[model samples]
Target: MFVKTMRDDKLSLLLTLIFSALCLLTAYRSMSMIAEVLLFIVLGIVYFKKSSIKEELNQREKLFIFAFIGFFVSALTSWIVGSGWELRSVRNPSMPSLIDLDLPSKYLLGALVFLLCVRLKWCLSPKVFGYAIGLGAMVNGCIAIYQHYQLGYSRVYGWSGIAEMAEASALLAVLNLVLFVFASCKKERIFYFVAIFLACLACIFSGTRGSILGFVVTFLFVGVMIFWKKRELLPIFFVGVLAGGLAFVPSLTLEQRQDTMRFDSAENDLKQYMQGNAHTSIGMRFEMWKEAIVMFQMAPFFGLTSAEIEKKMPEILQRSGSALVGIKKANPNNDARGKKHNQILNQAAKKGIVGVIALLLVWFASFRLFTPFLNTSGNSLIFSFCGVSILFYLIFPSLVGEPWESNVTLPLVTLLICAFYKIQKGQKIGY
Candidate 1:
């Protein structure tokens, strides 16, 4: 699939496009599973075909490898401690079963698959990659519109969990705007502009305030990059796109849906909480974070697993006293997700300090990986902009929910990470 022949390059490009198309659209978020199977096949082909393998590990790749290793180890140790050193635990959909490392492992596995793809030169060109992402976001935007207006849904989830959908919408918006900056042709440029509007609409319709936060941060990042690049005239046009994005929410027919974007009531939500009214969304999240703190205190190093966390909840809540009671009231049925509105806090309680460090390392390593492209040109410029800005969508939404740990999100991050590396490689490989 390398550039030995034009035919090989075309097939590689086609395959890459197909792979990119599968992101975030299917049940169980099967992209990672499919990537695992492909990686196994690639490994066997490399072993049997007597092909000489050659690729050096850069600082970015090495850091990513360590981060994922730490993440997997954290998950394993947490499960081990939670199981009481037992080899296996009872099966529960919301809990880890015996040897069940799939959650964290899938993230590492997805990265490996993309690394192999780059090694074989089976990756899209920067222009095509932009289109692939833009097209996917377009489809998701359509789905969001259909679900939000026609179906009378409160928000648009698009076959993913609420957090995943929120993160995706924000990510789609950010990337589309970035793509508009580095677009290769006039048609692509125009389409990317439209993508930005759709993506912003997705953000509004998602009703996840964190997505809006991410979008605003990314929008500013894009503007700064544009201004820094000395493309002074373009920022004026970009501002127009920003206005179109803001118009999406006002067009909504329902006041309640529009209220989702209003942060003015946040203070009121807090004041109500102080009066023992913890039903507001903001109040519930604050209370859940407090509970997570208690859980983390109980098992700071190894952390409790989901099952252990559940078993010890009553004891932890009793100790919490009247300082917090939203968790119990919000989840009388004791739903598995009662105490995890904030992803970082939830990680602290369940995975302990070890898992938390692993999570932070992944973010830090990714920061180092993409920011260097800031001084580049042509297609590689997309990497610098979209890659760094994408982290906002990944991390900000996780502040309010579990986007970072989502099946949909992990694979999407891995695929984009691979694309960034390979696009840089392609620059050297004759793109």
Candidate 2:
């Protein structure tokens, strides 16, 4: 009986422990890799609990799982094609590989978390799960504040890059708000509220405009969900007004002095870039997107190998009427270090048609996983809200930045998605 109890205790802690460590460890090291290792450990333990996973899988869950598998498989297939059919991890990005299996492949490990959540729902603790994310965000927030004031860094990236810091914090802030709303007591509420504030501070300090877009989208999503629930136009109208005003938040890196919004000069930055000054923050991304489009056209079906993509840069740069002339002047060897800043374009350019289809499949299945839950009420509705919120949080920012490529963002997104994937089937009510 004691051994059984101890085993159950470990099972209860599986998700919480891994995710809590992720929020803390990812800032210092390569979290996706760490998470992969930890997930396999959990898998080994789960191998013993095969009897407990008696819940029959549904069609949607099955489809999502398959789609997830297909996405990674397609990427691997492309990598094989790019690596001349080599089956090993291609460490050199400038080498012949089509996909960067080094980090992006770890995204597949998220399937373990999803499956565990579905099978071991009985052992999971929502409070522990919620608070872990909240505390993690709060800690990062505190560090960002310290970096901003004491360390004298222009943008407080903490240990991660400014993009990762801003993007991830803004996402956590919104998710933490859901926790704040559903807290049973003052202590939980205080913890989540402080977490929300600090996370937002980190977002602002990191100053990624994409996080601001996340804020606007989140506000609009809330308003829409509210109206969808209450079926009232008046509340939605007010929410729209609030959302419009709140649009003043979220931006990418556009300044050296301030990490947050640079609305006053954002227009100027674009105008200058249009006039052959492609050094602005927005300009660099826009230029890359344009070149990436050209890259995609060159290899429309299977896409180019990373080496081939790098090879094409000289021709794109040397074109007589190319917009990249300023980029060349700004950084003569600016091949974007062989990466397109946009996720859609980057995937399309590097992995081609198969890659694009894989991406779409992953998005569709994942989003569909939470749609049915959103129609629920009470705590279930709140649960779905956070789940869907985390989804959009990943989706929007990823359009501009490759969260998959980041050391922390992919693991962060994956764990958050799995964390919010509440076990909704025939569970006991807990209001």
RMSD of each: 3.7, 4.9
| Among all candidates shown, the one with the greatest TM-score | 1
Candidate 2 global CA lDDT score? 0.64
Model 1 alpha-carbon miss at residue 107, Å? 2.5
Q: What is the TM-score of each candidate against the true structure?
A: 0.85, 0.82
Counted clashes in each candidate structure: 0, 6
Evaluate model 1: give its TM-score: 0.85
lDDT of each: 0.67, 0.64
Model 2 ranges off by over 4 Å? 1-8, 24-26, 48-54, 82-99, 120-122, 185-187, 230-259, 318-337, 422-431
Give the range of the ten consecutive residues with the poorest summed lDDT in model 1. 84-93
Off by over 4 Å in 1: 1-6, 23-50, 84-100, 229-237, 240-268, 322-339, 429-431
